[model samples]
Target: MKNSKRWGRRVLSALAAAAVLAAVPVGAAGNGKSKGKPPASSHRYIEVQLLGINDFHGQLNVTRKVGGREVGRADYLAAYLKQREAENKNTLLVHAGDAVGASPPVSALLQDEPTIEVLNKLGFDVGTLGNHEFDEGVAEMLRLIHGGYHPATGDFAGADFPYVSANVVDAQTGKPILPPYVIKRVNGMPIGLIGVTLTETPTIVTPSGVAGVKFIDEATAINKAVRELKKKGVQTIVVLAHNPGVSNPDGTNASGEIVDIAKNVDDEVDVIFAGHNHAYLNAVVDGKLLVQSYSYGTAFSDVDLKIDPRTKDVVAKKAEIVTTYHDGITPDPEIRALVEKYEAKVAPLVNQVVGTAAETITDEQNESGESALGNLIADAQRAAMKTDFAFMNPGGIRADIEQGEVTWGELYNVQPFNNQLVKMTLTGAQIRQLLNQQWQPTQTRMLQISGLRYTWSASRPVGEKVIDIQLPDGTPLKPDAEYTVTVNSFLADGGDGFTVLTHGTNREVGPVDLDALVTYIRQLSQPFSAQIEGRITKLQ
Candidate 1:
């Protein structure tokens, strides 16, 4: 009897799903319409605009000079978006992902609450999840979406918009952490939106940030969600993925992993919005539109989709990459006020003098492969942990400590993730293996180091790159010798494609990396300054 009941339920479900699919035209641009001519006035088309941004990273008060124009700050973005949307009545403002994470002192210090409030006021309809969304862990991410107080940082109102991720799921329950998709009605047309993040999210972020959640393949997740949305009579689909883009100038023929995913996804998906590489791209792939504005609130992607009223399917689409310049654009008073509230709150902690820099430490690395800032950080880590040696990832150092007094906020911006120092033991050979790992997967940045020096031939074959290794005193490195190595928690967890670090044993974790820098800087007898010392020599 139970078996019979289950079978009956399946049959009923199939019938209902079929009815839903029949109600909506769920295929190509003109799915249910004749291809002969334009529809009549009664079946007129409505142009719906999609205003998208990605990797905002909570730059409420930061600015970047792009193309010789100073731009950015959440206020400028709000003002420009408001002006643009004013011209188009039917518009939806959305973010691809990383709206907040690895932010500056102004936003990061407040746990990004102010950014959320500003986004809410900005009228963000919906957004996706980037790997950074998981930086503070899933619980914090959930808190950011729903109204609640942080366990450590008091209560506050939360986001007005929902953050969806079709790919992020619970391992045990096999259920998504958030809603897989959201349907928004624009100009009387229901647009289905599915959100996805890079499947490699775990590899990039701190391991604890995404525990118990599984990030699945982007294309598979999108195809599945597209099918479900189609069955619900929602045909116009867009995917917000937190993946890097293979950029091409203008909106024609840009190719990358996103393009590959677009090609594999079902035809029902009309657009792809992406983040993670902080790039500006305008491309059409798989007969669909894909875009990503550069990060830090400096740019936005404006896409227009013409929907046929008769079929509710997207018939024509065009996209442009818009740079957000502060010139001539007045800051939205509400957003500026919102940013100032947080800015005022963080002043005391951020404005404290940390240390001094006699020489300007730039992020630009020398030919031998070391940046002054990177060397200083690596030195600080080694000093703080009392390790035999320490190495820093090139990506971790976000800003340069100028030749002046480095404030606490400046130090925070340099190592904003608040990662702790991890000391572990590795065989000399394993250390070499770690060096070789840098060249893998196409990113060949040598780590910023302290207490050791090595030369690797870039022209040499992959595995045998590191030619000579020695300590600072000229003692030769022995493959059989075990040595104490220090790295940040991100590296110890094998982040940034350095899986070899996971093998290290006898782990001893210490203070946060930024804190280590703070203490190390204060202890410097002179203003803390470092120069690239040819620690990592790459063959020309």
Candidate 2:
């Protein structure tokens, strides 16, 4: 429901660690005690501190709640990283992808250049590309990486750290656009880091943008890369992966795809850092370390790995996922200054007033079958297209709109990705199949519909579970008739398992998704209310 999933155990363990550490006296250290001189052994222990964050979406400035509490800004995140680096010499800061696009106005206005600038300044060692990174098209993505200038400052600066995607390849040439992996020498050890984005990139990203690119099997790519790295004599192998791992509600590892990848991957890989589902995870899977920090910089993960100098393999490791709270920590001066400068440059555009909301619209009710805000957004898209119905994935909605005067900034916050709307015609049978698929037990089949109503029994087998279906006008859906439906490009290209929508006829592009919503809201001066009633009913 929150458009992100994390392992519940990770969050609970983090909180538990925090609680236990808080109770101890300040000077008390855990079992990590070491003598002044090196111990007499053939192998040596080199402490490697890996700090990881993912799915930033280019938020540059701190956000204040209605009550003035601050959360996740680039500057605040930099401070957190700087503190950790100061404590360890063998430190590497990495991102697991989706760092650009879906950005706030400050970074969005500059086409996500500001966010990259901040990342470079913050000393990010490497990053994997997320599906959204291709939203601007592959050419634009390359331009941004090579010589793109920041929209806010007009300064031309390239990527400070290499961005890798071993799985994404050119369809015609079969060559990777960027290098698949890079070897970094950290404190006299040659560490091979392989970065891989999700194979679902084509389905989730705009088709035209990724027209000539093919995302290969992730496991295949990683295996191939690891073999090469090992041949090159690289001892320690770290994988920065942009794929989703199974997680429970409170942030613990759940048995899913990631577990299989960890257990079956080539033994050359020692650690796996993951993202895409935006869930927090810090668990050992099949004897390999797996971690995914929560999205939007809400938390950062610190993995302390002790590697044997002779074998270059991990001997002992500990991981802690820490939340970024402004209460006790002070912002790093350099990062704070950078954020302040960017905020000033984009102030006017970000502060503009947009519209009003009659009630609070939130993404918090993600676990439930229906969401008031998600329904309102789907309805708006349907109305804009003037079609038989509309459907929106809950993952597309990013932020919550409070009950009060809303600004264009607030609207952008809700649907920040700037995704376009596409209308297509589908047969009634195809629609039923699409509706039925939403009940899949795998959790990836859920759909957010706009102009339709249906009752379903999740307890039944997925495809046979739809009990009733009707059009927005309350007409019983005719299985043979063709109907025009409105949906975002993400789903039309088969994102979130809506392959049925891709089998439609007379497809046409409409307005951008967020633009359509903005237009609908601008036309209404009075506050509008929305509710999730029978749009999707769960029956026993």
Among all candidates shown, the one with the greatest lDDT:
1
Q: Backbone collision count in every prediction?
A: 0, 13
Clashes of 1: 0
In terms of lDDT, model 1 sits at: 0.79
RMSD of each: 11.3, 4.7
Q: Judged by TM-score, which candidate is best?
A: 1
Off by over 4 Å in 1: 1-43, 525-527
The sequence of per-residue lDDT tens digits that candidate 2 reaches over residues 1-540 is: 012222231232343234224212111212121112223556468888898987787877745321133446777677777877877889999988888777787777777787888889988899888877786788768767776654544655667889887888989999888888999888888888888877756655656767778888888888889998989998688888888774442334455566677777787687888877766566777677887766676656777788888877778876665556555566678877877787787778777766778888765444336778778788789888999878887667777778988877778878876667889999889989888766544564446677788877767775888878987678889999988899887778776667888887798898888888878877775686666666778785
lDDT value for model 2: 0.73
Candidate 1 lDDT by residue in tens digits, 229-249: 998888788889887774545
lDDT of 1 at 457: 80
